[model samples]
Target chain A: MFQIIKNEWRFLVRSRLLIAISIAFVSILLLSIFLGNYQTQKQEQTYQKATEHLRQQWVSIDAMNPHSAAHYGTYVFKPANLLSNLDEGVNSVTGNVLRVEGHVQNEIVHSEASQMQAVSRFGKLKSALLLQYIVPLLLIFLAFNTISSEKQSGRLKLLVLQGAKPLEIILSKTLSVWLYGVLLLIFVVVVYGILNFQNLTAEILTRTGLFFLSYALYYFIISGLTVFLSARWQNATLALTSMLGIWILWTIFLPNILMSSAEKWYPLPSRNEFQSAMTEDRSKGLDGHNPSDERGIALEEKVLKEYGVDSLSQLPINFDGMRMQADEEYGNSVWDKHYGSNRNILHQQKKSFQLGGIINPFIALQNTSMGFMASDNLHHQDFLLQVENYRRVFIKMLNDKQTFGGSKTGNWGWKIDNAFFKSVPDFEHRPTQISVVLSNYIMDVSLLILWSIVVIALIFFGTKKIKIV
Target chain B: MIQTIELTKKYGDFTALDKLNLSIKEGEIFGLLGANGAGKSTAINMLLGFLNPDSGKVQINDIDATKNAKDARKIIGYIPENVNLYPYLSGVENLDYFCRLAGLKYSKTELQDFLASCGLQSEANDQKVSAYSKGMRQKVGIAIAYAKKAKVYLLDEPASGLDPLASKELSILLKKLASEGATILMASHDIFRVREVCNRIGILKSGILVKELYAKDVSANELETLYLKFMQN
Candidate 1:
């Protein structure tokens, strides 16, 4: 086995194709790292500018009603992760900015894909794209000719006669290709580290490093399978064609089918239906202006009777304040029912996406990479939840101002001071850590490990029984 | 010493090797003489433990070839009909790899000396197999056998593409190996070369070895006539 590796290395050093390929591949990896860093820097600068402009708008608000400010609302967009330039993931398809307001929770809008002339389903020409698809195929091209060419030349028989075990030969060939993959992955990761020097926290570094290891295992499985097929098949062309066919099926056609099917199985209702449902539920629940809403009128009569007052003016606390509190509770229930269900629908969509493991490991890898980056559907849901929490706080504060600022039920002249407005907290978005993100993608990690075991088994015992004659 | 008893191989309904019996003495150059599809290569392949015969058994120096193929294979060096090697590797590198694979670790000088002994020139030793002629490649194949240091040598059409001089050199090498106590079994259609080098010849017809003749007892034309009779019958 060692001799085989030695021979392979000697041959590799002399082969211009292998050397040129490694050089070209490594250069491309470095170029991508530079491009990714530059692109992220560009995006962060634009985001910083946008955030400053929004803050300026926040400071210049007119002394209108507190509820009116709630209606106008503010927006907080999630910033892109530092490593996003490496993967670029579903970021292009999902929205970045979320709009928060009172009495209504709005869906995020202004996705990068929507603004484009045409959406790219395959995503941008990024490093992860090459690492996932092109690099492994290059490994296959390197390994598929390893054994069949030897057999065809009668060197295989010569080696066998010299007491070399078949399994040893297979291992040596597999190791050669595996080493190539390892070097390629390390090259990309070293570039990643050099570019993102600041964000090298332990969790981030570990996830990013595991991401490297998973991809390396993926490359090994693929190259080992290719070499095994080459040993089983008689002709070199046939082996190459078979390995390429498997590559296309796994990387291209299979993922599309699995994704589309998962989408069909876990259907998320259109935005229109969701909005209408919330509106219908909100109208029947409670309205601050209406004295005839059966539940609200009942509650009001009880409050008046208990306080022993003939009119709202006889009450100790402001009637407007009591009404605002009643309205907020009702609106909260309505959101809980409708928006909560929508969130569940998104979760269901994610669960179905996890079922793609049986057919394609690249899908598993895509999930793992995005999950660790905190750029997948789960993180998006968390962002929406945080926006909802902010909206609740913003609305509750406005209700407090209306109830306690001495405003009457129908008075339009009362106002809160700038002090109260300035006291409202701004929304702060915190992305989930890599460990928390990876926890949600355990199934994907398991699937990748499973594939590695199966391919390794095939390389070890599967070719021992091969009829070389 | 190599022996076979009623060795046979069947591929579903078509029988490739018939029930056959033969014994090859130690230190003798035994040639398997037949045309294409005559089972000469198949018989040699079975002795190398490449194929599982449907019935009967083969022994290499009293070690059952089927029951313990690894043991039998350890003592045999097979030179396949078409000599295919890694064209990217130089002659010396190829020899060194094959030698190492056989569990031998020789220094570069020793490897070069072995290559030279197989009639490869010092200039050619450094050249890749891609640049070598057909005869030179065959010499590398012979070098692989010589490097193995096995007790038996099996050659299937070993002289197919060689020029007359190269063929003569190979014949001389076979004689030297045989005289040095290496049992040699070769498959070839070259009846004249068989008569010139091999101590005995066996003709396989329709998956059966129908004729066996001593090389000195039979003249070239006489052997041809006898081969015709076996085929006609």
Candidate 2:
């Protein structure tokens, strides 16, 4: 069996067509890796510049009202890790810069897709695109004729006469072709390792290892199924056509249709509807700015009673700041209700998309690639949640300064020094740890494994009906 | 030795091979002459364990080819009408690859000798098979089978489109294998070549063996007349 597989490799290596194709393919893959790395590095440089520049401005602020400082918000730039060079995933569509201030929770803005000219439907020439799309297609083309060509050219009969069982021959040929895809994937991974020799981490290595494994599994499925089909059918043309049809269906048509279906099944509210509903809920709470309103008057009375003062002038602390802090807490609840529901909808949509992987493993590959690279919508949402949490902390600090900084009631002229602003912690985007976040990708991994099992089973069981004649 | 007992095959409503039986012993070359769809290839396919007989059994060297085709194929060698090989591989490489498939290993020099001994030129041994003529490919194909030291050779249409010189070489090679105590079953359209090389000949018409005779008893012209008469009926 091993010798038969070696012979298959010998046959493939001798073909000038294979050599030519390999040269072209490797050159393109290297170019894609270089470009993806360059783009990610440029993004890193931009983020560092923006972050440092924003912090510098914050440190230089003079004395100002705490609420005034809240209005002058700072922006937090999302961090791009090394693996983003492989699969940008939702990174291109989800903007990286998020504003953290007071009152409203701002959406991250300035996505690469929005900023770039809309020309290529296939985005940047990333390594993920080539490894995910082109490599498997090449494997299919090579494997689709692995057995049918022999059967059609009358070599299968000769080989069978030479003492090779049909299943053994089919499996050896399939492995020979599958190894081609694994080799390509390994080349990319080794290149990635070399490029990040100084910066390799446990998370990066684990993700890269799993990335390679996922693609290897996918490649085997492709080769196994294609070779099985080649043997099952009588001619190379029919086998090639059928495999091509499957490729198109799995990678192209089904993904879009399923994503659309998932969205329709677990739909998210429109932007306007979401904002208006949040606003309607917020209106039911006390308006912090309106001191003369009924809720504010009631709050003012309660605070005076607690402080044992007869009126506003008798109060020792700033009642306005106290009311503002209370209002901010109420606003946080409104943000949670709306954002939490949206997150749930997105999760449902993602789950549905993942379930679709049982039918098409390509979906699993896409999701796994994005997930491991921390570039999927889930990761993006995690970034937003972290930023929102930071915002709560940031605004509370400002509100507390006003409420307890020896400022009396209605003393709007009270201010804090730049020292307070400098002491306030800067927003740093801490991504969720891999150990905590890995559960989200379990379905993708299982689907990929299931796909591998099914294809291998088909190859073994289907060989019985190969029709060597 | 090669033997088939009441070998029969059917394709839906058509009887492809109907209760056929043949016994060819060692050191004998038997030729099967037939029309285009006369079940000659079908019989060759069955003997090679390529297709199952709907109702029959094939034995190669006394091993049942039907119940255990892989084991039976250990002693069988086959060359099809076109002798398909890896077009990108050299003659020697193709021989070595197929030999390895049959679990036969040889040094480079031994592989070259096998090709050289089978009448493939030394220069052509290293040249890719894509550039080889039909005769050269047949030489390598025979070398693959010969290197295995097979006990039986099942050939289908072995001389359909070869030049006269190549056809003569093929006949000589078949005779050489028979001389070495290998049973050769060849199916062909070339009547003169069949009479020149075979010890016995059988004519098949519409999946039935219509006539059988010794090559020594019939002249080439008489055999052709007999085959034509069978085709007309």
Instruction: Note the DockQ of each predicted structure.
Output: 0.69, 0.75
- Candidate 2 CAPRI classification by DockQ: medium
Evaluate candidate 2 by giving its C-alpha RMSD to the native, one decimal: 1.9
- Model 2, residue A146: distance off in Å is 1.7
Per-residue C-alpha lDDT of model 2 across residues A126-221, encoded as one tens digit per residue: 888998889988998898888888887878877777777888998899899999999989988888788778888888888888888888888988
TM-score of chain B of 1: 0.95
Question: RMSDs, each prediction?
Answer: 2.9, 1.9
Clashing pairs in 1: A153-B84, A321-A403
| Candidate 2 residue lDDT tens string, B92-150 | 88888888877788999999888877888899988989999999998998898899988
Question: On residues B1-233, what C-alpha lDDT tens digit does candidate 1 reach at each position?
Answer: 88999999988888888987888888999988887888988898899988889999999997999788889988887877667767888888888878877788889898888878878889999898999887788888878778777788889998887789988988988898899898999999887788889999999987898888889999998888887787678
Among these predictions, the greatest lDDT belongs to 2
Badly placed stretches (over 4 Å) of model 1 are A9-13, A60-65, A118-122, A236-238, A288-322, A405-412, A417-419, B12-14, B219-225, B228-233
